[model samples]
Every structure is written in structure tokens, then in C-alpha cells.
Target: MTKKVLITGFTGQVGSQLADFLLDQTDYEVVGMMRWQEPMDNLYDLTGRINNKERVSVFYADLNDFSAIARMLEEVRPDFIYHLAAQSYPKTSFNIPIETLQTNIIGTANLLEGIRQLKEKNGFDPVVHVCSSSEVYGRAKPGEVLNEDTKFHGASPYSISKIGTDYLGQFYGEAYGIKTFVTRMGTHSGPKRSDVFFESTVAKQIALIEAGFQEPIIKVGNLSSVRTFQDARDAVRAYYLLSQESYKGNVPCGETFNIAGEDAYKLPEVIDLLLSFSSRHDIKVETDSERLRPIDADYQMFDNTKIKSFIDWEPEIPTSKMFKDLLDHWRDEIKKGKVPLNR
Candidate 1:
């Protein structure tokens, strides 16, 4: 019998990509939980991404509703559960702190609590993978790389929420005996990423410049802060492998791992790489004070040793290729006249 994996945030970048990759490469079946009011338009390029569409199922339930989500988990009894849903914008969190806390913190607690209750009744516990962000390691000393051992110092509401969620995963594992794996994801991006992410923001601007749709100037935020970028596809692979392993594998319950590439670059350098990839050198970057984070993290990177040793996963895609892929996505959309010049 094929194993069943219950995944939330089915429409998100990592969740969507993971669903496709697993359906194509593994015998496990994926049942996605989405909060859509009406059935979302069948995922675009569905057949191209997933080999076994027949094995996929979707449930409609709000993440805020514990009872509904609990009932779904009891009915499904998935062998693996991947919680990838959250409100994940750092800058936007300043304006919507309540919503961010409610979704990232409370929503996660609900899942953990629900799973704990279900495990007690069913006598079977599903291994869970909780996707977390590197932002939890806020304000690292200059030139220091973060790892599973890195102490957390949250600087913003968004980071605080993630920190709470990360600890919540541990609480579930230690206090309730639910096997849980936590991943501190770096800056993962791809073609379908939303514009809120810095990579996509830069790529879209380059696309506009290349198409002669806008001025040769791109507005940006703090350029001095450094971050390690990883491909979403690769990140998802690490997550999948982690979830499949035994509870006592290298990364056991309550353990955390960082998923990031080897190279660390500043925001300006990332923007430059994107421009160079597009072969558009004339563009100039302008620093906009409005774009700066209210509580900016000065330095950030992650050591992948723990996760790499445990799952034999590493960041294989080069930074240039990641940027190029995103550039191509925006360029394709421009060719189709989908996005406007003023956008």
C-alpha cells in the first residue's frame, strides 16, 4: 500500500513543488489541505508536474479551525504530515502583526495540539515536518553562520511568530510524543515565487527593464545584509527525505536543521547577479528608505552539515541558475503581455 502524506499550503511555493516531485518520484500519495473557498482552478501544468494525478486529493479547511483540521487528520490518518502554511512576510508583518501571529503561531499550535489529541485516540502517530525560516536566527554576529545550534533572537513580529512555531513543534514532540522534524529554510526561490520575496522582486524589475517597459533604475532596500539562497526544489527534497526517515534517524524529534546553499551574498550582489543573468547591465539600483525592514537582520547564513549528514541532501543548483530560472519566468510572462510596465 502506498503511504499517504497530508500537506498544508498546497498552493505555496515549496508545498506545490514538493507535491509534484513526490507524486512523480515516489509511491507515496499526497492529500493537500487548502483554504480556498471555491475549488482553485486545477493547478496549472498539473500533468506536466505530477505523474499520478489520480493519487492526489485536496481538502478545504481553514488553518485557524482546529476542530475541522483535527477531523480531517483523523479521517486521513496520513503517514506523513508536512505543515508548510504561514503568513511569511517580514516587512508586511509590521502592518499586520495580529494576522501574522494568529496564522504562524496559533495556527501551528492548533495543528500540534490536534495531532497530539488524535494520536492519543488512534494509537498511531504520523511523523510531521514543520517548515521554518532562517529568520529565526535574527541578528547573528558578522561573518557567523547559523546552524541547528544557533541561538535564536527574534527581532520582528514575523520572526517571533516563527520562533514560537518552531518551539511549538518541539513541544509537540517532547510533551506529546509526536515525531517532528524542523527545518530552518534559507532564501529559497523559483519561477513561481511571489513578488514579496527579494529574489522575485529583483527579477521582475530586471524583466521590466529588459522589455524597455520602465526606467533603467530599480528601487531596493538594505543591500548590506547577507543571506544564503537555496532553490525551493532542492529544499523540498531535503524536507521529503527528512520526513521519510525513522524517528531516531540523524535528525530525531525536537531536532532542527538549516537548509541553505554554500555561498552567502548581500542583497546588492543578488540584484547584480540577476541583472547580469538577464544581460542588462545598464540598469542602476537605487536605495529606497521605504523598502528597509523595520528590524533588519544584519547578517544571515546557514550551515547545512546537520541536515546534509542526516538526509544526504545538499544545495546542488548554482545561484546563477536560480536567478536565471526566475528571470526566465518573468520574461515569459512579459512575452505573453500578462504583467504591465508600471507594475
Candidate 2:
């Protein structure tokens, strides 16, 4: 029988790309879990296939609702569950801390709790991938290489929420014998990246300027932080490989890994790279205090050794190409008459 994999946050860049990867590369039947009103922009290519139920389908449910999730699990009983849904924006969390906490922390607990009940009743065991963020290690010391053992300093409410989500993943696995593994992925971005993100917003502004929809000035926030950038596609591949490793018993349940790119760059360099890809040469850069985070992660250098020892995975796409793709994605969106706001 063909195995099924459940992917929450099915409309986001990584989730949508994971659906594509599974459909194209593996025989797994893809069950995408999303809310009823979720936008299909990221999953446009799969809409027809999804509608036909051609090895892909969507399950309407929210992580906060344990009953709905339990119902879905009872019917689907997926071989793998990729828990990717969360209040993912770090800056937005400052304003909506309660919702972020409820959605990420409580929401994750709801999912695991439902699964624990299902396992107790039905003896269902599935490989679960809990998505965590590198933001858990906020404001690392200068030039420090973050590993799984690094202390978590919550720089923002979102980071704090993710810390709770991370602990729940380990707790569920260690306490209940769920085949779960956690990943702290560093700064992954690419095409279909939301404009709220730093790199994607710059690309969007540049595209708008090229389309004569905005002024030549690109507003930005603090650019002092250093980070390792990887394409979302590459990150999803690591996710898939790690899931198989967990299932094969090569990885211990509840163990954590830092999946990231090798090269690190300051924020300004990333901005410059995006600017270099733009069609307009006269675009100016301006600092926008409104966009700066209240508390920032100054350094995000992560070590990928722990993941590599168990799985054969590494970043494949170049960051330069990722910037180009992001710029082009917005350009294509503009051409589709989708005039985005100057965010």
C-alpha cells in the first residue's frame, strides 16, 4: 500500500513545495491540511490535481481544534505527519502575542495530544516532523555556531512560542514513543516568499519600482544581523530526508537537528544581492524604523553536522539564484495585474 503523508500549513512556500516534492519524487499520497479559507496561490499548480483527488487532497482543520485533528487522523491515519502550521511571523507576534502563543504552543499541544489519544486507542504510530525555528536561539554571541545544545533565549514572543512548540515535540516523543524529530531551520526563503519577510519584501519593492508602481526608494529595517540563507526547496528536501531517517530508526525519537546553509551573510549583503538582480539601477535604499524588530537575532550561524551524520542532505540551490527567483516571482505577479501594496 502507498503511504500517506499529512502536511499542515499546506499553502505556505515550504509546505506547498513539499507537496510537490512528494508527488514528483515519491509514491506517497499527499494529504494537505489547511484552514477552509486558506489561499491557494502557493499551491496553484496542484489545484487541478487536488480537485480530482489524484493522489493529493486537502483536509480542512485547524491545529487548535483537537477534535477536528483527531477526526482527520482517525480517517487518514497518515504514515507521516509534517506539523508546519503556526503563527510563523516573529515581528507580528509582538503585536499578537496571545494568538501566537495559543496557535503555536497550544496548537502544537493540541495536535500531539490528539495523536497520543489516537495511539492509545488504535495503536497508530506515525513519523511526525515538528517544525521549529532557528529563532529559538535568539541573539547568539558574535560568531558562535549554534547547535542543538545552544541555550534558547526568546528574543520575541514568537521565539518563545516556538520554544514551547519545540519542547512539546520532544516531550511527546520521549513520553509517548511517537516517532517525532524536531528541526531548527535557519532563514529559509525563495519564490512565493511572503512580502513580510525581509528579503522577499525587498524583492517585491524592487519589482514594484521596475513596474513604475512605486518610488525608487526601498525602505528597510536593521541590517546588522548575520544569517545563513537557504532556498525553501532545499529546506524541504532536508525535511523529507530527515522524516525517512526518523522512520528507519536511524534517528532517535525526539532528537533535534539544526538544518541550515553553509554560507553566512550580513543582512545588508542580502539586500545588495537582491538589488543587483533588479532591472532598475536607480533604486535607493532607506531605513524604515517601523520595520525593525523590537528584539532581533543578531547572529544565526548554525551547524548542520548533526543532520548530515544521519541523512544525506545539504543545501543545493544557490542563494544568488534564490534572490533572482524571488525578484522574478514578484515581477511575474506584477505582470499578472496583481499589484501588491508597498509593504
Which 10 residues in a row give candidate 2 its minimum summed lDDT? 275-284
Model 1 residue pairs with clashes: none
Candidate 2 displacement at residue 198 in angstroms: 0.4
Question: What local lDDT score does residue 42 receive in model 1, on the 0 to 100 scale?
Answer: 29
Candidate 1 local lDDT, 1-343, one digit each (tens): 8799888888777778888888888988888888867334225656433445577877778779998888888888898999998988888898899999999999998888888888788676888988788889888999787878889999788999999999998777877768997888888898677777777888988898888887889878878888888888888888888887744455567677788877788887888778778676678888878778888887887788888677777888887898899889888888888674332
- By TM-score, the best candidate is 2
Q: How would you encode candidate 2's per-residue C-alpha lDDT over 1-343 as one tens digit per residue?
A: 9999999999998899999999999999999999999888999899999989999999999988988998999999999999999989999999999999999999999989988999999899999999999999998999799999999999999999999999999999999999999999899898999999889999999999999899999999888989999999999999999999888998788989899988789988998898887667898899998999999998999999989998888899998998899999999999999998787
Go through the candidates in order and give each one's C-alpha lDDT: 0.82, 0.92
TM-score, cand. 2: 0.99
Model 2 alpha-carbon miss at residue 266, Å: 0.9
* Candidate 1 Cα deviation (angstroms), residue 221: 0.9
- Model 1's alpha-carbon lDDT is 0.82
